[model samples]
Target: MIFLRNILFYPAFYLGSVFFVLASVVSIPIGPAPLRWSVAAWSRFHRTCLRWLLGIKIEVEGQLSREPVFYAVRHESFFEAIDAPAMYDTPVTFAKHELSIIPGWGRAAKAYGMIFVERDQGAKALRKMVSAAREYSQEGRPLVIYPEGTRTPHGEAGKLQAGFAGLYKLIGLPVVPVAVNSGPMYHRFWKRPGTITYRIGETIPPGLPRAEIEARVIAAINALN
Candidate 1:
């Protein structure tokens, strides 16, 4: 049944993606803000399709604070990336600059408040992230950053990256530690068929030093695993 579902699922998902690409392009001339919301809605629709296709249900926890709090989340699966847009009404993602290079995906990402960082230019990228995140916060939107910087395979915890502390310092907003566990279901290899949940936690106030903040975020995620 899982094999049959996977086969049926991907094609429908791809077709839906193409439609979203068209809707996004059509909305472009209309204006970016509207386009952004349209794309976000489209993404949510896409994830809903994925859930139905893969038979993967999601259970999200903790309140997504009404304020524009900075969310430091763990990276594990494609599910996480897709889940963010669906979960938040207004989400600004801090993704790698390379993602912006992809053809249709790149354009869609930029449309949605997705900021890219030049991997080679470490310091410059950090500064750019802070600036971009602050700009989003000023605009009254939440920023979603995968503190690990990249996706870690299956159950392994990816090494924590450096920018979260700086971003927290720059934004000066309370940090909401998001611990996601999609392992029992999604994986690069086994790809078990089941639901993947995103368990969001309460906001960790910013009084702690940079090191402590990093440790706290990691600990929060590890605890759930």
Candidate 2:
């Protein structure tokens, strides 16, 4: 049953994504809000599909802060990335710089307020990221970053990427580490029926030493492991 459902869902998901991407492109002239709405709508559609078609449910633990802060989320699968808009209001997600080079989707992401990071540029990239983060933080938008940089298999706790610590220090906002175990369930073609929980850990205030902040974030985000 799950296999059959997945077979039916894959095409629908891709088709729906293409439709929304085009919607985002058309909304470009309308402004960033409309483009963001299009993306959020896509997220909502996927969440609804997951519940109804795949029998997968979401269970969030702990409170999400209303104050603008850096959200250091564990990277488990693409599921958590798409689920961001559904979970937060106008989140500024940190994405790879390469994603911004894509044709229509890239333009939409920039207009919709994603922060692109040039990882290989070292110091220059860090400065750019800090500037972008500060701007968004001032605008009362929560910044979401996958500290592991890329998706890791479920139950694995990889080292936090180099950029996370720098962003934590320079952004000057509290860090909210979020652990999720969605990979085992949603990473595969045939997703299993279960609850994918976003376990929000305690908020670590800014201004802590580098060692302290890194330790706290790593431990907190890997709590589920």
Instruction: Rate residue 27 of model 2 by lDDT.
Output: 99
How many clashes does each candidate structure show, in the order listed?
0, 0
Please identify model 1 stretches exceeding 4 Å from their true place: none
Task: Rate residue 168 of model 2 by lDDT.
Answer: 88
Off by over 4 Å in 2: none
Cα TM-score of candidate 2? 0.96
Question: Taking the tens digit of each residue's C-alpha lDDT, what string does model 2 give over 1-225?
Answer: 888778767878778888998999999999877888999999998998888778889999999999998999988888988899998888999988989988888988888889998878999989988998899889999999998898888788798887788788788899999988888789876788788988999999999988898889889888877
Q: How would you encode candidate 1's per-residue C-alpha lDDT over 60-135 as one tens digit per residue?
A: 7777888888788877777777777778767898887877888777886786678886779888877877888888
Cα-based lDDT at residue 9, candidate 2: 75
